[model samples]
Target: MNNHIPILVEMQKLDDVIAEKLVLTESLPKRLSGLKKDVEDADNQVSETKTRLEENRKDQKLKELEIKSNNDQITKYKNQLLAAQSNKEYKALNSEVAHLESQNSLIDDVILQLMEDESSIKAQLEEELKIQANAKAELKANEDSLNLEIKEVEKEIKKFRDQRNNLAKDLPRALVKRYAALIKNRNRKAVVFNNGNKCGGCGYVLRPQVMIELQKGDEIINCENCGRMLVFHE
Candidate 1:
């Protein structure tokens, strides 16, 4: 049974290797997910800003048309006043010209406001475009880097699995089966340290008898609370 201690230690080392590989595998998707969200948010902001800029330009066009129509009316009313025979008709034509001028002035003011708004929006959109361009480049670079990293991690995981299979070949069927099952059910963390009297995996107080057995290091023992394989600490 004492000779079995070496085998138990080797098994724990294998478990550590597997756990580390699993951690590396889990990180890839999370990193990609977060970066993807950032890129998407930046793109949406750029699109919204561009839309506002375009709408301001359209409003400016409408104001221009309104001003032009008011100018035409003012010119027609002036001609009518010049040709008028009666005092009343002349006064009416003059009032019409004044009204058209007032309307044209208001439209001019509106056009100015629209032009200012358009200028501000264009500037904002330009900034946003620059930000989006930089973000797009960063996202592309990050994705490329992550793809390479993922490939390397997959290769390493494959290598570790191959090694694990080779190691399992020399172990007893019962022990291998137990280890595999625990790894599958326990977040890939099949092995845990025994911290003096406590099980590091579950914080459970190790039974005195179990602690003695662990000291013997003869056989694999599980933490009853968490069902994780325990390795005695140095």
Candidate 2:
């Protein structure tokens, strides 16, 4: 067996761990982003609810002013009816008063509806605030844990990478470069075994001569299809 084969296999083991931990460092942030999104959504809901409540109160205030103006006009019209000079004038004044009262009735109904909406909005705002609080709390907890995990994963990768590099010192420079290239290009796998008639890395069918050479273990061998170092395993 070529001395490089065993060293390559050992390096592959270290690289495997480094690669897997690197993936964790990436995915942990994505998980944190999702948690942040939940808090963001809750904040939006709370803001919207508060805005609705403010608008509802403003609308209620405007309607109250309108009712007050209508009442004042009704009192003035009543006074005019008392001093009316003819039946037609009194009838007209009375009709004006009735119309104003009808408007006031409709306005009252609208004010009541606005109050109900205000109540509902206040309740919704309370619930949304609670949700916002909970989301922030949950995010904080997970964020701390995920950030710690990311740091730990980074440390692990660095440790394994250093080990892998030190191990590579035992091999020739050209072989190490070739292995590194394969690892970078082949999804962090540089050494693979035969799986029946196929290459374990790419599932490329191995030729009979290729199988015989791998079984002999006389020298370093690569798969024709994938160019990965192949080892024989029963």
Candidate 3:
């Protein structure tokens, strides 16, 4: 049996864990970005709703001013009706007052309609504000949870790295260097035990002589086809 096989296997296990940690770390940014996008979308919707409400308020104010102006005109025509001296003048003044009254009625109707629309818009704006507030709170809570999880993963990564470095010290200098090089090239999995005459990592068939040498396990043996460090266990 190869004396170093156990340590090499330990190293491989650590390497697998490191690979998983690195993948998980890399995926966090994408997840966070997705969350940020959702938050931004909600905020944008709220902003648009606020803008619409402001426009409705301005429209309502303009209609109110128009109604006030029409009321002022109605008062001015009423005074002129009281001051009319002749029948012809009285009739003309009456006609003018009637026209002003018609305009006032139209302005009043427009103001009423605008007031109703303003109330509806205000209600909608209030509902949207509530929704936005809820969404913001939920997003903040989710971000806090994700941050805690990332911290835990970072702690695990540190532990794995320390354990891997400590394990490397127990390996021979040459073997350690070779394993490090393989890990750099192959994403940390340097050695795998073969099943019979087949390489496990790449499933390449091993020669009988190579298989026998692997069983003795005195020295590190690499698969000729895949260049992965090979081990044999009976």
- Over all chains combined, what TM-score does candidate 2 have? 0.94
Model 2: pairs clashing at backbone N, Cα or C within 3 Å: none
Report clash pairs, candidate 1.
none
lDDT of 1 by residue, 3-50 (tens): 544554565677677678678778986787777877788889989988
Candidate 2 C-alpha error for residue 218, in Å: 2.5
What is candidate 3's lDDT per residue for 1-234, written digit by digit as tens? 567888888888988998898887878756776778777877888788788778877887887787688778778877987897889998987787788778878877877787787788778878777877877776787887777777888899999888988988987898888888888886566898897779887888999999889988888899887688997867
Locate the minimum summed-lDDT window of 10 residues in model 2: 1-10
TM-score, structure 3 vs. true: 0.74
Model 1 score (lDDT): 0.80
* Number of the top-ranking candidate, with lDDT as the measure: 2
Per-residue lDDT tens digits for candidate 2, residues 1-234, read 877788888898998888889889889999999999999999999998889999999999999999999999999999999899999999999999999999999999999999998999898889999999999999988998898988899988999999999999999999898999999999989999999989999999999998999989988889899999998888
Candidate topping TM-score: 2
Kindly report which residue pairs in candidate 3 clash with one another. none
